[model samples]
Target: MVQSQTHTFEGKTIDEAIEEAKRALNAEMDEIDIRVIDHGNQKRFPFGRSRAKIAVSLTESNDETWETWLDNEIEDQDLFDIPLSPDEKQPVNTAGTAWIIDGQLHFHQTAEKKPILVIPYDGEVYNHNEKLSGRHVLKENDVIDFHLETTLIETKWTVKVNDKEQTVTLTVTPGKKIIPYIADHPAASVIEPIVQFDEQVNNQLQTKDVYEQLANMEVIEGIDDAAIHRACSAGEEQTVTIASGKLPKDGKNGEMAFRIDIQERSLPYKEKHDGTADFRESLYIPSVEHGEVLAEVIDPLPGEDGISVFGDVLQAKDGKPVIIKAGSGIEIDEEQSAVIAAQSGRPLIEQSGLLFRMSILPKKRHPGDLSIKHGNIRFIGDVEITGDVNEGMTVEAEGNVQMQKNVMHSTIQSRQNILIHGNAIVSAITAGQNQAVYDALQDIVPISSPRTDLLSP
Candidate 1:
């Protein structure tokens, strides 16, 4: 058994220490485990300075395995009975308050060192015989004289209007309730001792206060009373939608309607019970007869106007029109509002911005042989192959397919009739897109040589 080796290294930084360790041990980073011992501090000038230290230990031999190392290093512990510090250990920092209510003054202290409550400029308070001036702190059993204010802490609210003046939101800052003393007190008294008086937070806001604020802001069009009432009931610090503006609906753009069956031709493969689907079935090219309607042009619709909570008028949008023009092999019927095919050929559509250009190509002709270098051939119009169709090449046409030479190890299919004046050897060919004809053709023996008279069809 080879024993593990351990060493210590120090440098200005952790990366420098690891690099020094790696150079000294002549080992890569993954071959050993690194443990940081002390992260040294570097102070200004020469006052305090220390180097970073790391302990690099060689990993256990490959034979020991990770499970064995884990079993040797880790031990089970009793974690259920862990003890916690007592709550009395926590420090306390609390202050006291004082207030006056119901023609009487009171003061209460919560800690050893109580704060002195000073009389503000708006307060009408007096210290018995001599009227108190400036700041005055009342003590226990001290005599004080003051006028009886009817409502000490009244409900306060405010209204916020959006920048666009489209919405008005109401925010209510709840007031505190003046809790009168529980002890016996004389009514309309001249002097009362500062003994018992307290106050509690009152979250309930008044609706009348909100309405007065809204009226001041001139927001009366789309005010929601229920939302304001709910806000008043909840009373916490929150913003609610008191008024909302009606949003404008944009107009629908003009569209073109084409034949549904032609668009639905190219579909995804359907999975069979055997868990296999043929990709060729998903490929289809649609063809139209002469004078067949291709697309119907529809006009654009206009948009509606909207109104804001501030009674401002919002303008409506007018829908734009789509322009259409006919190219070769296509014609537009103005009376029927449709685009018709002029000849029995493939229909081609090209779109640029809002303009749609429709045309049709008569046929697609190949001057050379169909091979791997030329790739597969798929066209919407009839195909005319002048040369041979090579191995692994496929030809698919929407209309008729006419081959002049030989077809070897290839697939040729067409939606219409197929005329091949070539020798087909180990190749699949279908005429009129009939499944039964393709199946019967697959069973026929492959012809090796050119049999012009026997194979030509």
Candidate 2:
């Protein structure tokens, strides 16, 4: 959208001078995007030989954009548009007659014989007096003068000299008021002067509350509670504190709005240390928390190792083995055999073998197998399936549980071991550890198993 602007310059015509101003303003059009729309005649000397001095107001695309555009225009012209021409010749009628010392009539007086009338001259005002008065009697020194005056008749109509129509009042008598005229002209207002005290007061007020808070609060090594509180209260202005040096005023919402210079603290030790016997530095250290260590060994000894080991054993907790170790050629009495046989009841396994045992049975008896029907499911622990698990079902067990049939769209988890007996089909299966449980089911199949039943005729 094109914007309007007023540019004033003295030239022979309004258009010529206005075009010159526009050219000067548009010289740097590539730098600042400014487009002039139209020019307005602010104060025009229509009947003047004074080079038609005018305040040409024109419109631009944007007002703010015009400032830089005007700057560029001034730089390009190397001068303001203020005209440097001689004074203009006023209109004949409105141009007052010279004094009698110069033998001029006091036409400004209402009683002059041939008065040169000035009826608030705005532009060229013409007078039409068709009925002319014949030559009047005059002496060698008769004052032949005229004065421009306005007379109100019956408070209804007004008569003003120098207007084109001599009989009645014309609508164009008040061509344009001078107040608005001057306002529209270029350089109408002076540039404002800067007040340094006002700027300083504003800066002080901006940081007054923050400084007050900083002064009131306790000072600590790493915590600036007062500064933080002040910053929080300040909302948008915040301050930051350095660890071992003065607090920096560069933080957001605390103190300074932008960046501020701050000296960083030196390192604990200097690069080149002076050889002094009494030289010592106190360093601030943070407290560290102690944590348990977890280490893994291939063949661990009994007393010498942190974790005890047993063959065919899984874990030991509280000085008791969850799974017993069985070695080759080791004979067991009747009582020991019964105990061992009773412990080897069922093995619980996990879905992913990385977690729990895989392909091994547990020595202790466990709860019976649990089965689920169709639906999407997730299990937290191990699960045992006695019968066929339908599609889209999940089974979870804390301990190992065996399955009889194939599971579909489900998961099984176990802490110990998992054993499968019958054929498992049409499902996803996961195991925990490498040898946590045993899978005796020979017909175990993945979801990608071949569809032999579909191919049959």
For 312-358, candidate 2 gives per-residue lDDT tens digits of: 11232222112223332111233322111122222122222112121
Candidate 1 on 53-158: residue-level lDDT in tens? 9999776444335334433332243111212348555322122334344444444333243335454444456676666756555554567665324345655666
After superposing candidate 2, which stretches have Cα over 4 Å from the reference? 1-201, 205-212, 223-457
Worst 10 residues of 1 by lDDT: 448-457
Off by over 4 Å in 1: 1-156, 163-165, 178-220, 229-234, 260-282, 364-380, 384-388, 391-406, 409-457
TM-score of 2: 0.16
| Per-prediction TM-score | 0.46, 0.16
